[model samples]
Target: MSYQDIRSTFKLISGGLSETIDDSPKEFVSASITDTRLMGVVSMCVHWRLPENSHLTDLHQFFYFDAEESGFETYRSVLGNGGPSEVQEINDIEDYLMGGLGGKRVILTEREVRYMLQSYVDLNLRSGLSLPEDKDEYEFMLSPRVRLTDSEEYVLMCKQCPGLDSPYQVINYFLMRCVGKDFGAAKFLTKGYVRTNLFPNHKGATLLRNVIEDSPDAVSGSNTDYHVTDDDKDFGTFNTFKSYMCESLIEYSGKFFLLITQITLDHLKIVKYEKISEFQVSAAEASMMTSRPEFITVTDLVPSAPEFDRHTTKLTSKSMVTDYENGQLFMIFQPHNDHVKNATYLLNDDVLGVYYLLEDNQLILASYNLSDIRRMELDLAESSMAPYIVPVSKYEFKDPVLFDFINSSFDDFEDFVATITKPPAE
Candidate 1:
């Protein structure tokens, strides 16, 4: 094929790469090359920058024409880039393209480079070459199953969970899941924060400064409330083959919270503290939750409280509730008004709304109709009455004590370590 025709084919492949890959590199370049050893055998070279830790920005991949196979084959497939031979081939191609004028090779634009990098990955995948470990980590980061751990009660409700290989995964499965995206739960209810190595250059700790009694010191990376050190012998573990993931329920400042951590002998990879609302009968409930060791579906977490279940059923079923202009009218028949039985209800004088608890212990505030309130005040007790409810807000009361217990703490950090961990025998 002519150089234009070959370039056209590569352009099409790169375009397809652009549409598919989400975390494609922003800086990269591609150039055409020819091998003097193999006549008419052309190759495409892709180069990209690396992270600061890599110590080198110049890294490359070479896709070459295979005369025997009559197709382009991946020449440099592993982590290391192609060496001198590939560089000479590129120089030869540049000389030919420049008509022996000896000019610099053309660098692909930022947009083109992104596609080129993805194209390099796609070709490597098709050729059955080993991908970089970081690429695999990135794939895990983008997975839907991994991201699902960012929901409240996800890890707590989970009967079976895959072993977390990194601190990021640990954070998602515990802290992020408990508090969600906003720092709302941590700000108003909890008294702790999460520390992780997920963002190395950025701040290591996140959320819950207001409730924590002590301010973060300079030694512990002042961005957080407090920090733990590697020298602390209590965290030392002999097992190094597999990572350690520990969870605990704690009571501090007279409030309850869950502590989940992934650590090693030298590094405390991740630590999260999330507040919980209830503690009674949590031991019995926690035992039942962990009884099954298999993965569970969303249906398993459906609210089980009797009154809440009945109310949800009615709301979902169109016949039991009527949708008015501004709100829903819940029908209550005098003879049998058991749908909302045994459920906690509270009235808010400030907003003139009612707050009710669901089977799952989620508190929901609903606005009442002024006309309905007036009718009740006038002593009009009809056979059937409708209480207009406009769903305003809701909050979940995840009981920390119900968590599958790995450990617990109420003592200060120093005392906790000393009590839990004993010094090695002399």
Candidate 2:
């Protein structure tokens, strides 16, 4: 069944299932078993805190639920990081113990992802078994916001769609359908990104649109049937897009990062900003969530250095951008005092990862990846989390030099370079 159908069934059977983990109870919830990450792990979170000390320290021995066998089992990965363990099968499969993005799963928010790395020193994390220290570097590899996947492609075989014969027109329709609900027709066309912006010079679609227009007479004869239906026009919009895709426009269309959709850019342009100015001090509220190294080496930020230890929502604008480097960019804008964070970000280059700098907070296109972001199990009772993420760029960084300078200024830049630029030590 589809996600919607299955979701309806879950609501009907469970009678408003609520999830309560730790001391907190999430009221009225339902569960489903579709796609999820960390197949062997499922969490029940009633609170955000972890216990003082979790008995389980060895990342290799974590338990996972085996959906196929209807029992708990182990999953073997050839490229293993070893955070999973095998527990004995349970005869009683309770309601909360079902599969997928349900249960007390910890949603990796921006603050949560930052807390994970700097707070915990024990747990090692993995993203597809590939862990990068900083968020921006990791975010550089995620799926882009505007992408067309192939398991089942949307095809407009019928024609009545406007720009049916134009590939770009079809894409515009798709984007229009996929964008935010409130975008009206005039706002999009008046001051929006046009297809011509992406393929500057009308290079790709120019010839195709021309061919269709000129072929009406040649297909049959002079004035054979110079007519098209409303349905045909709509479908034509869809067909032009599908035909170009099938003819390999997507595969060979080199510049995928040229983001051009009516509603997307509108959403990106923000009027207010909360930005962190300097590095946060060790004693500030920022330091309260993130843990400092116990040894207190020179490599660490001097707890008294007001310059490197201050925390604000502001970040340098020109930060280096990668596909999903760590989706960990911590940017500061002039308007807001707090940075909007995201553990997941969409990239211009067709990738997705944990992005720290939030889209809503700043007009800039970067997220920060601290040197400490890691993966660890949160033990409820103690307000501590060890989440890891990669920061990604929402759009291209027009300036390269400034981008590098901002990221390298952070302490974690050394670690970020090592993980993403080289293979892990064997």
Candidate 3:
């Protein structure tokens, strides 16, 4: 039968069959189960007759009836004949409706029915399926079990039921309608696309908002306007180069060295001012030097001295000398005619300490010690002559490994010279 017809039939039978024993409140209290599977069980109670002048009795009896089952006969047997009650399978809705009805039957008005249903809803929210000790556990029990299969249905229900504002009520309704055994609403709620509008403005909704906002898909965007271009890549590369240049200065003691082929007059002035103040060549002199033959012999530039060693026996005119003293001066000599080549030799043959060469406005400064060349490079760079400072070697070593070993082990130029020039260990 239809739900309204069943409710109306239950109301008529309950009112007509109720036994009125005393004038002590003829009010009939009734609760109904709306579950279709349970066939709607009704619990009705009414006050029983008491002896005159006898104290009000505490004992009260309530009749359990279901019209969808065996009808009035079964109810009468249970209530009137006092026979063995039939075992009836009860669900959550039936258990909730039948509880705390006392033992009196009464007809409930529409307002009373609504109030009782609201109370049942409230009680279910407060205590969940059972009275759990933890409030969070109770909330979990009331929360909807939304499975992947039923998620669409639950979402539709949420959209349709605009009046269901309470999160607990919405969850409970969805859970009651769901057929799946496994549920994962919490995991689903963490996804970015899930709609949270149906949820009440509570802590769970707030947390869901945070989760959505923090999601990778939510935080990232696909805007074509923000995409990187070749210009941006170039700019990034430029910035990286600038950073490397700046850091290299720190690595090399606040100085940058470069091997450059060309040098301007202005660059020459910076080199002269910062490094070599004794550079007496004028612009006219530099121009004159570049115009001469590219190949010039060492004898033409500087006079050679007699080779000698202070530690060993004095060298005679015919003796051949392979090595020299530590402080001995030498001339800057280039083996080949090419000025572009940076490899220059410091003649082991004794010679004056100072010599200068100029080609195409490029100046080469040479001295007996390596420290002077390093100092000149530093001063030139400090004066913004970084592009003009050449990385040419001042002298070629007989043993390149020994030279490198000394350079690596010693920071002081004097120590390097002393260590390299010391007598061989016995």
Candidate 4:
């Protein structure tokens, strides 16, 4: 019988078996037999049991591959064997079963399977899989199981396609087989675009010329066509291992050496002067050096209070005076007030500044450079020192009290440090 006739016979048998079984949970077996020259030519048959369901119970697929046919064939068998009884065409049958059984038809050639397996191995290696750590376990987990008429033939086929030994290979083979070729084609087509646009140019020559003109003494040598070696390339420049990578012509002196930047993560700023060239290739590095100011902590400076309150701590330390001269101390000025006792003041160098902490956890830096320290000192001297002072309070000045000042003046520790130590404008 023809393939369709055989399939129809199986379907009829399945219907009859389903009717016989009714809604019972027990499995109902159905069998069909066909006799024809086409059925006799079946070289290989693979049976795969599919997921059973309420509507379609105990579904199974039987795939048949004939040596004479170009394309393989398959049929759905609901219960049992659905082929002729006296069929003797099983010699060298395993060679023809290219298409996989069941609903998921996986058709893979020997070459494709090999490539898939190799790709799996490559992926595992990339993921840092070690041979010393349960190599057999990994292989077992990754290997694909193939069902065939002959067990020996299946084993031989699997050995031939080493990729089948890895499940990674099998999965990747089907998933990436079509897309991998597309990716390769796209990479080839866009190779020129990537080379031309992706890499930024470094004007090292121009930068060197500027350096030479600015300081004639700094110019030591000139290489117009300098070729950087593979070893010289900075691959780790973007990584955390190194902050910056630089290549320059200037030689290092004991105290100073002119650095010329070529390429950086931020921008492509190159400075070249004839022979002496320096590049500020990294904007991030330059911003960090110039913008970040150095501040000194002054623990000795006294907090401002009423002058008549002689019992308050006195600023007798000469070190405080020295800090003022050096322009490093951050002094606080608290005006004599009854309503707001928590208010404080800050001195940024010679400039008098007022700061307050807001309810939103923000340290606001405002109303600075309004009054100079010299003016405030003079005003304090002229004001009444003996005012109606409040009685002995719980306020005690110490290093711990500095936190209250910081919390009131700045958002956090980092903010306070950044604000207080900010260098004066150039």
Which residue pairs come into collision in candidate 3? Answer: 28-106, 28-107, 29-106, 45-104, 45-105, 46-104, 46-105, 61-103
Whole-model Cα lDDT of every candidate shown, in order: 0.29, 0.22, 0.24, 0.25
- For candidate 1, the TM-score is 0.17
Model 2 residue 254 CA deviation (Å) reads 12
TM-score of candidate 2 to 2 decimals: 0.19
Model 1: weakest 10-residue lDDT segment is 341-350
Candidate 4 lDDT over 33-130, as tens digits, reads 11111111121222222234434434222333221121122322233333332121211122112111101123433333333333335544555543
Per-residue lDDT of 1-426 in model 1, one digit per residue for the tens? 111112223211111112213333424444433311111223445555444323223444444432221233333421223466646554433322222111123333333323334543554567665544334312322222211224423322121123324432333323332322223222222223543332233221211101111112212223333344463436563222123333433222233333433322212232233222323224344333323211100111124423322124322121123222222322221221111111111111111222223223332222233442333323212211113222232222232121111123321222333453568889
| Candidate 3 worst ten-residue window by lDDT | 242-251
| Ordering by TM-score | 2, 1, 4, 3
The pairs that clash in candidate 1 are none
The estimated TM-scores of all candidates read: 0.17, 0.19, 0.14, 0.16
Error of 2 at 89 (Å): 33
Instruction: Please provide, for model 3 over 1-426, each residue's C-alpha lDDT reduced to its tens digit, 9 standing for 90 to 100.
Output: 111211233221121121322233322233332221111233432223333323432112333433222222111111122122211312221222233111122343333333333333354455443221222211221224323335643542222222323222222222212111111322221212222222122111000000001112111222111233587587673122100000000001221121111101111010000110111234344223222111111111112312222111111111111221222211222122121111221112111122222212222333233554454334334543334344443443333222232225443333444676899999
Q: Residue 277 error for model 1, in Å? A: 88
List runs of model 1 lying over 4 Å from the truth.
Answer: 1-26, 29-41, 65-70, 77-107, 110-426
Mark the regions of model 3 whose C-alpha exceeds 4 Å error after superposition: 1-426
Q: Please state the error at residue 409 of candidate 1 in Å.
A: 83
